[model samples]
Target chain A: MKVANEQTTRDRIIETARQLFLTRGFAGTGIAAILKEAGVRSGSLYYFFKSKDELLVAVLDQYKGLLRPILIDPVEAATNDPIGRVFALLESYRGFLLETGCRMGCPIGNLALEISDTHDEARDRVRENFDAWCACVEGWLVDAGDRLPNDLDRAELARFVLTVMEGAQMQAKANKKIKAYEASITQLRHYFEMLESRAK
Target chain B: MKVANEQTTRDRIIETARQLFLTRGFAGTGIAAILKEAGVRSGSLYYFFKSKDELLVAVLDQYKGLLRPILIDPVEAATNDPIGRVFALLESYRGFLLETGCRMGCPIGNLALEISDTHDEARDRVRENFDAWCACVEGWLVDAGDRLPNDLDRAELARFVLTVMEGAQMQAKANKKIKAYEASITQLRHYFEMLESRAK
Candidate 1:
């Protein structure tokens, strides 16, 4: 019972910090805010996390763990078509923007831009999250087989998808308009169509 | 003499704040630090700018002033071919990453993700800077003429390019490696090739 209760407390702290970091930003968010929001004592938070930075890392770890469930699986279930899944994934982001009024951006993209220059451990974890995302896209591209040019460097193309998505989201959030996001995704779709037509 | 000197002091302060904001981030950087770095007193700094947010808007406006000479003109000087100019601009960023070991990502991108949720004025400024950048790229695409599909949406394509560049830079900066950035650029190039071939 004690172990179960302890694990729940830690997870609650990590989850609260994660949402706050995404919404409030890493630097803008304070340890006190997390404790207040989570309804946990500072003693419990400090016992689980050595400092605010450690809590951020814990939040990042949770993101890593949640990617497939939060990001990939829904899109995967929606479409088994490999290339289709790519766009489906983007469409989901579109819905996310709709719900948030284009705020909160991609958690990793936001965090990466915010702290990649200064934080070492957090930066590596952020990169790993990004690389793992690219890997998922790469897997879809691999499944794409001859639909894409045999010579196509799927790995790099995967990176491009990520680039467009993050860029689109950032611009959309900044402008508080969905048009920028849609415009970028439309262009990416056209690029894919061009590639697919060429392969034929 | 007093007027000219004051203008110099204000410019110096904006420049210092811009660099520090890029390196240490907006939230992490303090007024005292900006004062120290710019070698100006609190009264002097506040006399010119009301608050840190106000100072950031000034820095962003300065980026607007510098965009042509700093980003577009150099690449234009390198290549007469319109399409080539696009890639040249990306190459310049690659060089920037090489120099900084991918430490500081795109200034607007970092700011957009960092403050888009919280700061209304700053977010607008960031988006305007982004739109200005996309317009420059759109102008180049328009110049490319029959090389790309006439059916192509030049404006959205420009947005896509911005997305890719910002996204690629963010990833490269996060990982402190140029490969991710290079990979993304390569994919964009290939996408352009496919479009050109289709036009042919």
Candidate 2:
């Protein structure tokens, strides 16, 4: 019973830290804030995470684990067409921006840029998060098969999709408007149509 | 002579802060660090700018002023082909990644993502920077004229280019490799070719 309780406390700390890091950024957020919000004492917080960096790793791990359930599954459920699934995935991001009034973007992308210069371990984890997300999208493009050109590099295209999503989210959040996000998607759709036309 | 010396001190402070912000990020950098690096005292730092936020505005404005000369002129001088100029502009960014070993990406993009959530004035300035960049690229696409589809939305395509650059920079910085940057540009080139092939 004590072990289970400890596990719950750890989970709560991770969850609270993740939200704070997402909304306020890793640099902008303070450990005191996380402790207060999670209702955990300093000893417990330190017991689970020796430092804020470790907490960041946990948050990123959670993001990696949750990518399928929180991000991919809903979009996949909405569409079975492999090519359509790609856009469905993007549409989910668009939905996030609308829901959040463009206040939040991809938490991983935000951290990827913010901490890449300062932290090595955290940077590697951020790269892993990006790689995992890219791999999921790559799987969809592979499932797309000959609907895309035989010469098409699925990995590169998958990376491109990731790029567009991150870039679009940056623009949307900065401008406090969804139009920037939509414009990128519009162009991406055009690119996809062009590729599909060339398919044998 | 006194007025000129004061302007020199102000310029020195902005330049130092700009470099520090680029490398350490806005939140990561401190005012004391900027003053020390610029060889200015706290009094002098405050004499020109009231706060760190005000200093950031000055750095951003300096970036705005430098874009045409520091970014566009050299690329424009090298390539009269409008499309080629776009790639040349991207090449400049590639050079930055290679030179810094992927430690630095786009200055505006770095600030755009880092400051968007926390500072309204800075966020608006960042958006303006993006707008100015997009407008420059849009002009190139417009110059391409009959080389692209008449029905093409130049503005949207320009925005797409910005998205790719920012996204590519994010990946490059995260992975600590130039390959990610190269991959996005390769795909962007493919997209450009597809558009050009449709030209009348």
Candidate 3:
């Protein structure tokens, strides 16, 4: 019971920090801001996180944990057809973008832009998350098997898909248009169909 | 003579602010930091720009002004063939990326991530820059002439192309791999080819 209470406080701190980080960015957000927003008070925030950086790292981890399933689960479950799975994954992302009304950029991509050189640990985490994502994409391509080109490179394809998704989301948010995201998915789907036809 | 001196000082301040903002981001960088890095006195920094936010807006303007030619000039010159112009513009960006070692994210994209919602004027500049860029792309598509489908929506296609380019750049920078960017361009070229074929 006591552990649960402590965990709840920790979770609240993470939630508040994540929101602030997404809305204001890491540098703009401070420990005091997180503490005040979370209503945890300074001592409690320090008790859970040693510093603002540590809190930001914790918030990043929390985001990663939340996003992995949102991003990967659809692709993972659509194990039946690799190409279909890839499309489904993208479609799911499109749905999310539409629902959110295109507010925030990809949290992972945002961190990548914000912390590439200044923070080694953060950079590594961002890279690891991206690699894991690419691995899932690579797995889907492998499942596509005979349908994909005999020489189709899975890693390269995954990277391309990720790039489109990340970039499309940013564009959609910037322009406040769902069509931007849809356009990427449409082009990707067209490309997939072309690849499948070439296999025949 | 007074105006010239003032312009030089202002230009110096904006340039220094641009480099710092790109490297450290908005919140991580302060006016004091800008003055120190630019070797300009604090009084001079403030004499030209009213506040940190004002300086950030100027930095954003500088970013747009700098990127305009680097991104748009090639496309503008290759006017004879819209499709060709598109590829040439992208190729030029690749050269820039290679020259710089892909150290910084797209400046406008970076600022969009940092302050899109938080700063309205800054966001408007980002929007205008992107809109202008999209217009440049649309002009290329229009020039692609009958090679593109009569019914093919050029605006949508332009947005899609922008998404892929921006996303590819971000992914490439995040992983420090040129392959990511290369893959997107390759696919994009393929996409243009498909449009050409379908139009015919």
Q: Best-fitting candidate, measured by TM-score?
A: 2
Instruction: Go through the candidates in order and give each one's DockQ.
Output: 0.88, 0.89, 0.59
Q: Is candidate 1 or candidate 3 better by DockQ?
A: 1
Write candidate 2's Cα lDDT for A127-166 as tens digits: 9999999998999999999889998899999999999999
- lDDT by residue for model 1 (A69-146), tens: 999999999899999999999998899889998885688988998888778999999999998999999999999999
Compose the digit string of candidate 1's lDDT tens values, residues B33-103. 99999899999888988888899899989998989999999899889999999999988888888988898
For model 2, the stretches where C-alpha displacement exceeds 4 angstroms are A1-7, B1-7
Fnat per predicted structure, each in turn: 0.95, 0.87, 0.55
Better of 1 and 3 by lDDT: 1
Instruction: Output the TM-score of candidate 1.
Output: 0.97
lDDT of 3 by residue, B23-121 (tens): 778877877888888889998988888888888788777766765566677566666666878777778767767877776647777777777767778
TM-score of each: 0.97, 0.98, 0.87
Ranking by lDDT: 2, 1, 3
The clash tally of candidate 1 reads 0
The CAPRI classification for model 1 reads as: high
Error of 3 at B175 (Å): 1.5
lDDT of each: 0.90, 0.92, 0.77
The lDDT leader among the candidates is: 2
